[model samples]
Target: MSAIKDDAKIAVSVVVHACGRIDLLDRCLDALVRQQFHPRRYDIIVVDDEPNHNTLHLVAGWRTRTLDRGPRLSYVANPGPGGPPAALNRGWRVARAPIVAFTRDDVVPEPGWLAAGLAACDDRTEVVCGRVQTLIAPHPADAQPGAHALEAADFTSASCFLRKPVLERLGGFDERFDIRGSDADMYFRLLEHGIAIAQAPVALALHPVGPAPWGQSLLRVRHEEFDALLYKKHPALYRQKVEPSPAWDNYVVAGVLLLALVSALLGMDIMAALAFGAWLLLTARRCAHSLRGAAHTPSHVAEMVVTSALLPLLTVFWRLAGAVRYRVRFA
Candidate 1:
């Protein structure tokens, strides 16, 4: 990758949509300041999706220690917690650069990131997605526990870069999605518009992936709901991106758990026992499959055992919530 020479105009704008993870955001900011690329080549625009001014003020506070003179950084707010797409839209409005790349507040880019990313975008490809691994020292095998790391693909996470022409061509991220799958949707749209999406495995970024969320919270419901909305937009395609064994296994376990609960309350002990046995059986298979890749510690095994019991339930609850919310009528 070519190093930034004598002061090129800031042709790239790195749009980061951040909320609530101040520590991780600070880490990204630190990495940005440490970037070897000339500050004039790119500008960092952070959109504070959170309502609190503290998130933006924190970025301002970092300048005291960061003392970054390279890229000009600015923070903006969205219209009433409109989520990632909304935040990015706000960021895009103020963007003066010809290229728009995306990253999460939790991502710490490597030194050659900006240079490599821009170079990858010059011709043929309109969407450039780089690699991201867990930020935690001994990172989890998967960014989300129980799942595996994303394979090198034609697409990456929301952390990819979009050329200005292509960004304008696709008309920006769809605001209909509050979050989730919106990144994938954008990539597919790029393809529809004949824009190539390529993977730059050498361009590494550290993602501060947190503990996987499990349970029946409103967030869980909303995530699934948004996914359903996404599927509605591209039914056949969603099946391709988010399908295969692990998901179907999850679907079956959900049915089994519901059966056990309802059957036990109806005082059908035999039926309840069978339902419970089915759930345990499915959980064992899932845990075994997920734990197969390496040597397991007590904590890992314990976590697997515990999460197995609830993961399926959480997944189903979310999907069902999504389907209902989006009025998804699956065949």
Candidate 2:
């Protein structure tokens, strides 16, 4: 890491959190390099969660290429505990500017993104939330088996700007909610502290939804563990903003299937048949809901059926696991 010169006059430090997706990172960097903001007033920092030769080389190449013409580009390796929050912390802590802008490697900002974000940051504003447009598959049939769009929330870290001093005062992000929910937690904390958050509608970024393999939704169930932590930390805000009620449908589905299994083991053939029929009905409903606007290919339909039948059980298990681990009365 080279030292930032004393007279560089950097105003905004754009922190991009990346994993090993060099292809996406390459596009993100390309967009940043062409920002409408003054090139010398802002710098780009790429924080790699899992830094390897490919990421290092990509950042190094961008740094060399943009050294004279554009904002200075640098790479930082995330220290310990891997997650977006940790990577963001690493990026801003080493930033040369007082204002920090956050975005992901998969997102491509418009040319005026930085300029608009900076414009919204007045003396009274401690944070600025930018707009993000998500691009998904052109057609349902072309969508991948487990494809999903990224959530373009009101105050996601993917397109927000924050004052470095305010971040330091708030202790940055809570690393315990490692997989997710940290961004909303931070936003709620800012409100608690009476810090002003402004919205910049003109600062736009494009997040392209990508393909995923089969069973991707099942793999995402682990994110529920952090929901317990978020709720424990901010019950009122979590209820108001996140979820007002538990997923009652998931519980119903799981309970019906369990009842069917127990009745069969007890040799109650009639009761087992009824419970199994109910379970099938509920599972079919879920599968139909999932396939509403999704790909309707035969394989996609099969995937939805199989995953929908098992998702309720998995979701309930993870929710309970989170509640137990966090010692919260969440469900």
Candidate 3:
């Protein structure tokens, strides 16, 4: 790849959404300083969602220390501690470049990430989506790959480059997605508008899956609410791209448990035993396949196994709630 000329007109503004994880923000900012692209050719904007002044103070102090050779850095405070979508919209509003890139505080972009993303952009490209690879560190002692061990997603806000005009025309991210699914919603809108999205395989970002509480899966069950809304807004596209098959897994899991409970209540011991056995067998098989390379240690594997068993039940329950709230049957 050729080096970007000093006089080149292409400059990118990177917007990072940081919500109280100052350490991760520090690492992300430090990584940006090492990018192969010229420091003057790119700018970094960190949007802090923390309501308190601590995050702003931390960034202010860190900004003074980074004036030597790093890209220009700045921070924007959210109106309140809302969510990433709101923070992102605020950051991009003041962006001064033709290319507006998005990433998260927890993500660290590769040194060539910016260069590759810009190189992938042209008159025909409306959006440039980089690859996101999940880093699963099962144990503290294990060596982490500087790059991704496995690629997790083809596109995400974790790393992306979009033309400033298109973003402005679309009026930035939809705040309706207060927390999750906003990234997907943005892309769906762009596609609907006949915009051409390109892929930059070399523009990589590492997404580390941090350790979490056992109830984390239950919290994620809330995605069903967003899914219901997403489907309601764009039924054909959502069904075509997001979920081609019906939510049979949820129904099947719930059906087995319901059958078992009914049989037990009716004093049909043999039927109850068969229904319970079937549910266990199905859950075990699915868990084993899904956790193949994701779980690295015994503890990690155990956590995943237990979470998998509970996730389906939680999914069905929340799906019902979402259907009622949205007044649309997901099935």
The best candidate by lDDT is 2
Tens digits of per-residue lDDT, candidate 2, 1-331, equal 2354632578999999999999999999999999997788899999999979899999999999988888888889986789988988898899889999999998999999999999999988989999888776754432343223234465888899999999999989888875358888898898889999999989999888776666677777778888998989889999888889998989999999999999999999999999999999999998888888877878888888988888899989989999999999999
Candidate 2 whole-model C-alpha lDDT, 0 to 1: 0.86
For candidate 3, the 10 contiguous residues with the lowest summed lDDT are 140-149
Q: Rank the candidates by TM-score, best first.
A: 2, 3, 1
For model 1, which pairs clash? 39-70, 39-71, 225-322
lDDT of 2 at 232: 92
C-alpha RMSD by candidate, in order: 4.9, 2.4, 5.2
Residue-by-residue lDDT tens digits, candidate 3, 160-257? 99988998999988776744467768878888899989999899887776666544655666677777777777788788877886688878987998
RMSD of 1: 4.9
**How many backbone collisions does model 3 have?**
0
Tens digits of lDDT, candidate 1, 1-331: 2233422477788888888778878888778767777766777888888757677788777654445465667778775647787788788777778788788786788988777887788677777888776544343532253222333344654457877777676677888775556666776677666767777777777666555533223234346556777777877667776652235666778888889999999999999999999898889997787677633877667666776677677777777777777788632
Model 3, 271: alpha-carbon shift in Å? Answer: 3.9
Task: State how far residue 125 of model 1 sits from its true place (Å).
Answer: 3.3
Task: Please give the TM-score that candidate 2 achieves against the real structure.
Answer: 0.94
Which scores greater on lDDT, model 1 or model 3? 3
Worst 10 residues of 2 by lDDT: 141-150
lDDT of each: 0.70, 0.86, 0.78
Query: After TM-score superposition, what is the CA distance of residue 61 in candidate 2 from its true location, in Å?
Result: 0.5
